[model samples]
Target: MAITKIVELVGESKDNWRDAAANAVKEANKTIDEITGVEILNLTADVKDGEIIEYKANVQVAFPVREQRK
Candidate 1:
């Protein structure tokens, strides 16, 4: 059996939501390993002058839990 854990993360990009989502995972990877997947929770955009200036991604990142030690 394997153990998994979920962590929330938010990322933003000037390009698109896809990049934003990818960035979240990329950043998480800096500290986390054994990543299984990511579930996007929400997507939004920043508006300026009635135009979207940035894309935001809210996601739940899943990875294997670290082993416990005594």
Candidate 2:
């Protein structure tokens, strides 16, 4: 049997929503192993002076559960 875990994360970037989403996975990868997939939940942006200053993405990251060690 196999089990997977899902974690929610919000990533921010100065480029675009796609980058923001990718950033989430990249950041997660730094601490997580065996990442299987990602699902983008929401996309938002911060505007300043009539221009987008930052992009934000809400995402769900999935990974397989690892066995525990004592």
RMSD of each: 1.1, 1.4
lDDT of 2 by residue, 1-70 (tens): 6889999999999989999999999999999999999999999999999999999999999999877737
Q: Write the per-residue lDDT of candidate 1 for residues 19-55, one digit (tens) a residue.
A: 9999999999999988899999999999999999999
In model 2, how many backbone clashes occur?
Answer: 0
Candidate 1 matches the true fold with a TM-score of 0.92
Error of 2 at 40 (Å): 0.2
lDDT of each: 0.95, 0.95
TM, every model: 0.92, 0.91
Q: Evaluate residue 42 in candidate 2 and report its C-alpha lDDT on the 0 to 100 scale.
A: 93
In Å, residue 39's CA in model 2 sits off its true spot by 0.1
Model 1, global lDDT: 0.95
Per-residue lDDT for 12 in model 1?
93
Backbone clashes per model, in order?
Answer: 0, 0
Q: What clash pairs does model 2 have?
A: none
Badly placed stretches (over 4 Å) of model 2 are 67-70
